[model samples]
Target chain A: MKQWYRDTGLQARMFLTMFLLAAVYLAFISFLATTGVGTMGIVVVAGIFIFIQYFYSDKLVLWSMGGKIVSESEEPELHTIISRLCQIADLPKPRIAVVENNVPNAFATGRSKKNAVVAVTTGLMHQLNHGELEAVIAHELSHVKNRDMLVITIASFISTIAFFLARNLMFFGMMGRGRRDSGGIMAVWIVSILVWLVSFLLIRALSRYREFSADRGSAAITGQPAQLASALMKISGTMKRVPTDDLRKVEGMNAFFIIPAVSGSSLMKLFSTHPQIEQRIAKLEEMQQKMEF
Target chain B: MGFLDAFLGKTKLPKSKTKDIFAISTANVTFEVNLNLRALNKAGICFKPQASSHFTQARAEVEELLAYSCKDTNTGYQITKDAYGYTWIVLEDPDFEDLVSNIYLVSEGLIERDFGEQLLCALFTFKEKGGANVYWIYNFKHGNFYPFAPKANKERNSAFEFRLRSVMEKELPIEKDVERWYPLWDVPV
Candidate 1:
C-alpha cells in the first residue's frame, strides 16, 4: 500500500506541472516590475482573495452544486460503506453528501482533512452497483487522504490572479500610467495575458495527473482496481448519451466529473481535464497485475 | 486500537481474549439498573466463512460442543447470517456468568480447531433506558471493545455512548483508540 503512494508517477507529473505554472507566474511578475506596473496594492488584494477562496472552497463547491448533507438515516448504505472503508484505510470519516443533479459524478472538497465533504450526484447512485460505488467513494477518500485539494488550490491561485489581472488590464493599465510609466503598463498587460494562457494549460495538466493519482489511490484502498475501471467506463459511456444542451451547462465543471465529459474527438483530448478513459483503465490493469505478483 | 496501530505501523499482537470477555459485564449491569431490562441471557459469536473441508468440520464440532454444554444450563443457541455474509452463533443463558463462559467455550473451541482467522467479532446486547437497544462490540480485528448505543432513528447517540464508556471503563477493558470503535450500525435482534 505504501509503495502505491511512492510509485505514483502522476505525483511527479503534478509537481512538474506546478513548477511550470510557477515559472509563468514569476515571468509575469518580472514583466510588471520591469515595466513599472508592479503595484503592491494589487498583489495584496489578489493574495487576500486567494486566501479566502482557499479556506472556503469546499463549502463553495458544495453550495454551487446544490448539495445537501445526508446523515446515516438518509443514506444508511452509503454511510455504512464509507465508514467501513475509512476503517480499512484508517482515516477519519469524512462528511458524506448527495447532490440532486442528473449528472453521474462525484468529487471530494475541503480545506483540510477533518472538514472534507464527498458529494455524489443522484445519477451516480442510480448508475453504480455496490462494488462500483465503493470504488468511487474510495477514490474520493484517496483525494482527501492525499491532501489534493490544498495542493490544487495553491497551484491554481496564480492562474486565478492572472485571469483577473488580464480581464481588468485596461483599467489597471490606466491607473499604472498615471502612477508610473506607460511602457510598464503595456508590459504588464502583455505579461498578464501570457501568464493566463500558460498557467491555464499547466493547471489542466496538473489536474489530469491528480485524477490519475487519485484513481490509483482508490484502487489500493479497495484492493479492487477493476471495480473503478468499470465504473469509469460506465460513467464515460453515460456522459456521451446526455443531451448536448445539458452538457454545455456543466462544461465549466467538467473537471469535477468522475469521467471527463468529452465527445471523444482527438482535438478535444489535447485540452481535456483528464486522461483518456482507456489510458486510466490500462493503468489500473497494470496495477492489478502488480498486486497479483 | 489494534487496527489503527497496525495501519500506523505500531506493534502487532493478537487481540487479548480477556478484553473481549470483559466488555459484556458492565452492559449487563446497566441493563438491570437503569432500564429494568433483563440481560436477555444471550451472547453471540461472529465469524467469516472458510472454504476448507477441515475448517467446516471444525465449525460443526464447535457448534455441537456449544449445544451440549449449554443444554443443562437452560441456555438456547441459534446461528444466523448477516447481510454482509458473516456467520453468527448466538447462545442464551439467564446467568451472565454462564453466558460469558459459554461464549468463551465456543471461541476457545474454534481457536483450537484452527478456525481463529474466521472469528471476526463478538457482540453483547443490552437494553437500557426503557428497552432502548445498546451493544458492546468486541472486534477481533483490533482485539478491543467499544460501546455502540443505537438511537431509535438508527443513528448513534454519542453522549449516551460517552456516558457508558466513562461509567464502565474500569469494569470493561475499553478500547482506547477512537478509530477502532467502528459502529456496527445494524445488528440482528
Candidate 2:
C-alpha cells in the first residue's frame, strides 16, 4: 500500500504522553491501595460512568448539539461526500447528521467504527466550498477510524476516579473528628488531587495530539491537505464573527469540534482540547509541500 | 486496520483495489442472458483531482499515454469534469472486454503515479428493454461492485437495483453493504 506523509514528531509526542499517563495512573492506584482507600469502589464507579458514556455518547452528543440525522434523500451531497471518503478509508458507512447552528463546525462520535456518526452544522455547509466540506468530513471520519471516542474514554478512566475520590475524600476528611485517621484521609485527598491535576493535563495533551493525527489522516484519505488547511482557516475566521451566545451554547463540545469554539487566548493552549489553528495549518502545509515533491 | 495502527492513531488510506474490476467483464454475459440487460459499450472512471501541480503534470502524461495506446484498440475516450468536481475518463468501445480493460488502464495509470487514493469508482452503463439506465459501479477504493439504477428527478429505482444485485452477486464482486452503493447523479458516461 502507498503511504502518505509521516510525522514522527507527533507520533513520538503521543507515545510519550501515553507513557506518562500510564505512569501517573499506576502511581495513583498504588497510592490509593497504600492509603487503604477502597480502590474497588472507585473502579466500579468509573466503570459504570464509562460504560454509560461509551454506549450512549452518540445520542447524547447529537442531542446536545441539536443535530438531526438526515437521510440520503435529504442531504444527498453530504451523503455522497461521506460515502466516497468512507470507501477510500475502508470504513463502514457511518450515520450522517446535520446541526442547525451556523457555527461552521463538525464532529464525530461513537464507541466504535460500525456505530459512528459524523455531523456537520448547517453553518458549516453554507460556509465551505465542496472541496473544503469534503476535507472537513474526512477529518471527522479519521477520528472515527482511529477510535478517538474509545481512546479518550479509556484514557480518562483514572482521571474520573481521581476526581471522584478527590471531592469525596475532602468531604470525609472534614467530617472525621479524630486526628489519626484524619491525617490518612488528608494524605489520600492530596494524592487524589495531584493525580487528577496531572492526568487532566496529560489527557488534554493526548487529545491535542490525536487532533494532529486525525488531520494527517484527513490528508491521507482525501489526498488534499491544502483543502483541509483552508477549511480550518475558514472555520476559525467565521468563528470570530459568530455570536458569543451561539458559541457559548456549544463551548462544552470544544474537545470534539474541528476547531475550538473560543479563540484569542494563547495561554489556554496547554488546557485546550485541540491544538492552535495556526499550528494545525502549518502541519497541513508541510504535508502539502511534501506532496508537491 | 491493525490493532497497533489504531493504538498509534494511524489511519493510512486503503490502497486502490481495482483488480476485482475484471469480474464485471465476465459477468457481462449473465446480465445479457439472464437479466435482459445489454451493455451500452460505455464506461467512465471517476477520480478526484488534487490541487497540486505534480498531479496535473502526471495526469497530462497519463492522458497522453492513454491516447497513444487506445489508437490500436480503437477505443474512444474523452476527459470531462462534473459539477461535483470529479474528473471522468469516459471510454467507448463495442467490445465489453475493451471497455473493461480501458477502465483498468485509466485506474492503473493513476495508481502507478501514487494517486490511487484519488480514484473513486468506475461506472459501466447497461440498458434494459424499457430504455431505463442501469449502471454497474466498481468502487476502486473498496474493490466492490454495486448496481445503480437512476430514474428521473434523481430518484433511484431500488427494486431494479436490488434485482440486478441478486442476479449479478454470484458473478461479480458485489458490494454487500447497500449503504456503500452511492449514487453518482449526473454521471456523464
Tell me, by TM-score, which candidate is best: 2
lDDT of 2 by residue, B71-147 (tens): 96899999999877889999999989988888888889898988888888899999997779899999887788999
List model 1 lDDT by residue over A1-293, tens digit each. Answer: 12432343555566677677778778767666665465656667888998988789788999999889998778988887787666545557888999998878999998877899999999999998877888899889877776777777777787777777777766876765675566666666677777877787787777777677778777755656778987997887843544466777888987765654445787666578889888888888776665544
**Model 1, which residues run further than 4 Å from truth?**
A1-6, A26-35, A238-267, B1-133, B138-145, B151-160, B170-182
Model 2 agreement with the true structure over A34-111: per-residue lDDT tens digits: 775444665677789878978999999999999899998899888888887787788998999999997899999989
Model 1 C-alpha lDDT versus the unseen true structure: 0.71
lDDT scores of the candidates, listed in order: 0.71, 0.86
Interface C-alpha root-mean-square deviation, candidates in order: 8.4, 1.6
Clashing pairs in 2: none
- Among incorrect, acceptable, medium and high, the docking class of model 2 is medium
